[model samples]
Target: MVCRSVLLRSVAAAVLVASVSACSLWGGRAAKPVAAELGPNVAVLGVRQAWTARVGKIELPLELHVNGNVVTLASSDGVVAALDAKTGSDVWRAMLGEPLSTGPGSDGKTAAVVTRANALVALESGREKWRQQLPAQVFTPPLVAGGRVFVLSSDRSVAAYDGATGRRLWTQQRPGEPLVLRQAGVLLALGDTLVVGLSGRMVGMNPNTGVTQWELPLASPRGTNDVERLVELVGRVSRVGDSVCARAFQASVGCVNTARGAVAWTQVASGSEGIHGDDRAVFGTEGNGVVTAWSRVDGSRLWSMDRYKHRKLTAPLLLGRSIVFGDDSGTVHLVSRDDGAPLNRISTDGSGIAAAPAVASDTLVVVSRNGSVYGFRPD
Candidate 1:
């Protein structure tokens, strides 16, 4: 069996265990490739670190919630904080006093997170609003929008709660592939439609009633074994108006016309992370750390860059004129979105970037694995 053992860890809800001698998750039996060497820092893009702050170590996949001038982020040890994007000053800070599995998803006013003990806790301004226990383990960050808290659990369940009172509004359970990924899944709001990723399909639901509106498959499961056939849609999708494009883990990348409930196009892409883009093109980092740009309209290859290959890169973030990516070496590379040319490189705390870089109020913020939050501004 490719998936030999299943262990529940603090980082992930469940981890896939494989053999060192057989085909592993990091591609095939080939040896790991060395990261590409970064040459001289051109620093053509004039940017400087604006400020820095500290939080608890971020071990889980916490989504940095950017709302206007404020960005809300959480640590694995249950420290949730809202920081001013420009000044890096704390707007408010709250400690949950436990290890969190995922979250700190906020809608500016209310923040939410899933604890390791399966409790969905909500906070307002810096105080606990309510806490509700979930039926299954949650890996995806709870979507706090439309005055409702939406959760996508590891067992492929979608539940909604009253954002204020933690009242159970409704729960929608769907049958899925036997094995669900322990990583963060897609749960976002597309106007009135509640967009969620269940297995390899993106399903649209009614936020008020939890009724299914439409479902579009991004990738089909293939291969003989369960591990080989895992095709779950990860988080951090690219949304351009009514069009949404996402990646089905290690399977394919596709765009969905949410307005029409139709697929624009899909191409086989061997990547595990989600994608980001503008109206013209979408960008993604492959499992080998090769960055790629695809035409948004037709899914054609726009360009590709291998300078960061094998570096274990996070998802690409299209910020202003530059495409931003955080690598395993605690380096944030700013490359040209048009051709992936080196623009600038910024160093973090040498503990690796914990999540994809986010921007708010013209300030770029990235969290390190050691809980250092660095904010940068264009100079």
Candidate 2:
């Protein structure tokens, strides 16, 4: 009887392993191997006006900024170029001595660019104002607030420098891996808090002196089993109003109280690649090809759609009453702010859109991966 029982246990274990393997085969849908098919039945708006320019002839055009009639483009070749926002005419160009990891920061009068070697170079109208070297590499764009430029370095140091003179103001260091500031780190001037998204957590710092206010861990503690490993992915944090939202791979979306440092709510999702929010809603895109929207107040899912499935999404761009997002196939989608319903769709010839579209007046400017910049106005 003991031998029979042992054999039966072994058989059950084998069956369980087989079932998991079968599920794994179909699960985790890799981005479709082939380029996505463009739908023929829908009417995509034609390009109203397209402008193409080569700035410094650099590859991997990472970040774009448009302030009034001035546009700045940062490239991997250690150069930042300013152009006319409407005509793409050259305004001025400045070359940093080292390759740039983060994009340019501007206060409409002065522009700050950080390099991989930790140098903060400030420029105005294409002329160098000052340069200062810090102790580590800066992977995140500098934030200009209250006459200071705040920079986050790969060595986990956050420092504030004089925006006009590159003078070091204050520095604070954390214990985790550094984070890249895709959009400028959220500065809540009213709360006196500066929010930064680190590797697996969201950190709140005092805006004035770079003091640690609070730190919130985002991911679950590591587990011993394979199931836990599958769920272990990095968390990304962003600020929407008084709340700081941290999203992790396969983990629940967590909203932390900016002032109290306590978790306000948590909502589960599958992937962490795309998570964005505004004053009204929280948005996330999962590996399963679903984009979901939730209420910012209570963490309730407002609406969901699979139309954006299988395509990588650009970060969500919040317009006045709508959200604009672009996918891998060069399709730009606008969804209603209230119901998440599709409002309009337009296609650009460019393949991959890396940054969120910039809006100036009534015009929307989108930069493609191939260096093609297109401007659109409502018809």
Candidate 3:
């Protein structure tokens, strides 16, 4: 039950969470491994709090949408606001007056979010433009790109809608296991191709017509039961040119060459969070709070850091010379991008970080579970 509770706190949106045989997740409740002690804050990497804002508590997975210098974020209570990433000032805020499941994906102009009531609402400049009813529950943030709102529902269905009007464009459904992760799945635009994560495969689709272009499996289902075989790609992928590297739940991490529509490489990884990288290495956090860096060219281990083991870390953000991660203690960790060495740590509201840290216009922003939005700038 402790393992399940930790998972629930980390990925609160997980649906139909099945029973696990062992309590070995994140060090488990049996032994309860103690977290590593932090060293003195030497201020090796200079960072200062820029601004702070408030919103409703964010219990579900919320993917911060960055368009230019504006970042759009949503809380569980359906309070969607776009803030200037630099100053943490609100560009515009909208209250949907309903509980939201996921999102606040924006294209600098239009913002979109899905409510727990199965409604997709689009806002333009903080004004409600239109709202459309969805057939299935959605956990992935709607991709607002190219004048369209794309949604990947929990039932392994992909649908598109007009950004201006709530007109349905096309819906594509794929056969998948009945159990699906309610976390944010991969849904992004690769050039003109709509790269989506279906089950454990990264499928390329034509955004205009919703036609399948190419399909590459990153992981395959292999277990006795549905929960054991569950493999879905998470978000916050590392995209360098035509190559997009993503994680297949707790199975493996792989890169797909979108241009060639072929897999570059795949390495077995027991991490459940998404990955981030630049040109050299891809970085991810394992379930036990081990941070790993893998070579981007070939899926090989570059370095692994376990200093924060059992801390329940979120996915990382590759910012400048450091990779930033948030933990269950609401502390922001900055580690060396070249080596997984600790650099610095920043404290938050003590309510724990709700999601992965995001950066826009040189400003790093992290939202806490208590809905404290803090923006930091490198000094």
Candidate 4:
């Protein structure tokens, strides 16, 4: 009886979190969570500020892509920038127009950005190379591989374009869901196969021919409510040796074999954001703000930290001896990577973190929701 009661309470809590959604759940469209009180800082954790820059206004949970030593960043205001990873200096900045919805996808040689006008813009060095129109609005960043750019739009289509000339290559699509979240998914190039996340599964494609290689189901839609069925792969993935690790929006987290398209293991964890890892373990935050770590080899639980319950974690990052995470309260927490205990923290701007911090070599790049970008290092 006690076990059943606990299980019922857990399911109820998950439903409550899902119903709140990303936006305003009281009425019309979805909305982001309102700014929460900063509460109290983590006192001290030995994290030192390396540099800070204002890389335009960050309204969405857009992630920063790092290629070479230049990190590509995009803002909702149509501003895209390439910053030096070591110094945090702007290598180049291009203003597209009034509003930019997604991207700043880069593979060092080329960069791609998407606008709110349903367009794909490519840049070389700092110059505009070409721009192409899409059939629908885009919610994820473009994936540049080989000589092609792979884009998954709101119309539930995965299409490829020539990065050099912006010509349409080939397109494959799935049925669009009634409701979708605007979060980005992992789009990576694995040898000859291209991995793109659709509504609830991961589809591997041929970059040259746009052919379906393999389809691996990450999360199946199995909820009674409209909000509960809104599941998709969120954030970026962790590539450990031969395994690809990822998480579903509010479902399970697992690691898959990239070459054979086989499911290794999955644990019932719920998080809207994604995950991060090292050579040994995978770390992610669940919907209730519990940071859990699992072994990369056998998916064994290492430890879990739950002090920040319900704080709305962005994503968990591993930095030196600390497992770092930024919360909706505009504070960054650092916990022991060895034991998962709270260590220290610092505040950005009291507006919450925008996305998972991008790791460039030894430095960590972070952006807050209120347009503040910061660089930090273990001190």
Q: Tell me each candidate's TM-score.
A: 0.94, 0.75, 0.93, 0.87
lDDT of 3 by residue, 59-176 (tens): 7768888888998999999899999998898999999899998967888999999998889999998999999998877888999999999999876889999998989999999888
Candidate 2, residue 333: lDDT: 75
lDDT of 4 by residue, 123-241 (tens): 88778899898887666888877878888776667888998999998888777344456657668888778888877787788887778888888788887855557777776788866
**Which residue ranges in model 3 land beyond 4 Å of their true spot?**
1-32
Note the Cα lDDT for every prediction shown. Answer: 0.87, 0.61, 0.87, 0.76
Distance from true location, Cα of 76 in model 2, Å: 1.8
In model 1, the clashing pairs are none
Q: Between the candidate structures 2 and 4, which one is better when assessed by TM-score? A: 4
Candidate 3: Cα lDDT at 13: 28
**Candidate 1 deviant stretches above 4 angstroms:** 1-31
**TM-score, cand. 1:** 0.94
Return the clash pairs for model 4, or none: 22-31, 23-30, 23-31, 23-32, 24-31, 270-287
Off by over 4 Å in 4: 1-45
Best by TM-score: 1
Least lDDT summed over 10 consecutive residues: which range in candidate 4?
Answer: 5-14
